[model samples]
Target: MSMRKPLAIFISALMASSAANAAEVYNKDSNKLDFYGKVVGLNYISNNKAEHGDKSYARFGFKGVTKISDQLSGYGQWEYNVKTNNPEAMDMGNATRLAFVGLKFADFGSFDYGRNNGVLYDVSSFTDVNPEFGGDSFTKEDNFMTGRAKGLATFRTSNFFGSIDGLSLALQYQGKNPNPHKSEDRRDGNGEGWGASTSYDLGYGIQLAGAYASSNRTDIQASDKNGQTADAWNLGMKYDNAQLYLAAMYAETRNMSHYGISNNRYAKKTQNIEIAAHYLFVDGPAEGLQPSLAYVQSVGKKLDPVSKSGDAADAAASFKGGKQDLVKYIEVGTSYFFNKNMYTYVDYKINLLKKDTYTSATGVNTDNILGLGLVYQF
Candidate 1:
């Protein structure tokens, strides 16, 4: 069996999902290295003081691959991000976004371990293609196996063991991170967890995907007696072709979605939905321009009533079983690409959630937001 076909497919898929247009820096003796980075000048205008400000950032990463043999290969990637809005003397809020290494066994599958994206992102990513903000229906960072996090072992296979076409599957396991600091947010910590995802291309640029993840909550997280475990599931479909893209997803979570300032409260149950569409002009004066529209909403059910006393016992005692809207907005945007490595975009989020007691007490932002950005990647 030839390794050329499977290896090419794998590499193509990886590049399609990458945020940068990587440039090959080395390709000798079956070892290859690529360098990629992006700089973005961004700002947001909103009624909420916290949300209105400069949001510029700089990100860079490297990817390397080595062909060990006809049936084996090794690969690794590392990415870092730093906020550029602050002064040089202040803390820039730097962080590592991805750092992982893996081995691929030609037509069988690939296994990797380290800080990486959660398996559930496979489905949610379909609708997360807006110019600015869009994936907030039910996905969040450092919230169990729902988004990006630390300590994950992932195994993925494509083409269904080399027999079926356009089919892929993935399985993941996460180690416990017992964040012991009491002052820190507990939502960032989690216990043992596992996840699985699958996707199939039905042909003609249509695809279907689904994923599920479950994890145990830390001791401090469950101290309030809300729930001991967090679980989430998502299903999505998308159509992508030469000139148009459309996607939609529906998701549900139990004891996984966070609320309130510092994410101090957890919702008992939540339901979310997102839909997005974009069209590109391949020719004429509108060439290189794309317009986007999207709708996203998330609702929490059986929420614990908040208390003004700031006492845990009082808040728990006042729980009369409530429900509230967490996020609701419509996004309209457009991006014009000067070339493959640079673009400018403007996105506006039309807030739909009414400003009321529930939203005010929970610190939910109901103000409309306007974002403008210019990006250069290579």
Candidate 2:
């Protein structure tokens, strides 16, 4: 077999595990390294001033693998993001997105530790493919074992030890994370937690996935009349071929969702739903064009009632112990790929939130957003 064939296979495997576009830079003595990055010039227009602005950013990462033996291997990855919209003198919003090192045992599984995505994302990610903004249904960064966070030990196995053709399983554990700053929200702090996820590929480009996570809340977080434990679960389904993609997910969280700023409070419960579809035109005049549509909604239930007292901070605080709509929108977009390395996209988010007393008091945004962006990746 030619080296080109194995290199192509390795690249394809990496693409399946990550979304970034990468190119192999070295492959010698059973050791390999790949470099990947993307630069996006993006802008959004919305009636809400906070949401209207430039959103340009650049992200880069590297992946390396060393084969210790035929049955054992070592691998690691590091990725960072830089916000280019900020002035040179100001904070550019630089952050480390992913950093992990792992060991893989052939035909057994892989174990890794470091800051990485939570197991719950295994299911929620099915509907998170919208171009601009559609993954706001409960998965949040730095919020316990939900999206991306720190201090996680994860173990993953594919094909169930080679007995099943399309089954995958993952188990994760998270250590307690103390708030770095005193003023930070208690919701950012978490106690010990664990999560599990499973997925089955049913042939013909169809797959089903589910995940569940539970964690202990910090003392301050549990002091606000909320439960001591935070729990979440998600179920999702997706179908994908070379030309089309479709996905949907439903999730619920208990004592996990938080809202408000100055007088922040946690929602006792939250329900979320998301749906998405995309079609790519290939081998025609419209080749390299893809159109996307999606729907996303999140509602908070059993919220604590707030009294409208004379305090200035309580002026806009009002809840009647009922469910509140956190997010609701329909997104439509299209992307035109100029080639394998470049693409441009336009996305319009039609805000479906209604204006009412609750929305007004809670400061929920009801303005539509239009986003445009150009991207180059290698």
Measured by lDDT, the strongest candidate is 1
Give the per-residue lDDT digits (tens) of candidate 2, residues 212-327: 99999888788877779999999999987745778999999998777653335677899999999877666557766778999999898987665345233464555555787878
The parts of candidate 2 lying over 4 Å away from their true place are 1-20, 261-263, 306-317
Q: Which stretches of candidate 1 lie over 4 Å from their true place?
A: 1-16, 180-184, 308-321
For residues 1-378, what per-residue lDDT tens digits would candidate 1 score against the true structure? Answer: 333333333322432466346889999999999998989999999989988999999989999999999999999999999899989998658889899999999999999999899999999988888789798887887788788888999999999888899999999999998774565456688999999999999999899999999999988788768778989999999987745788999999998898776587788899999998877665667766778999999999998777544543564324344788888999999987666677899999999998676665556788999999998888
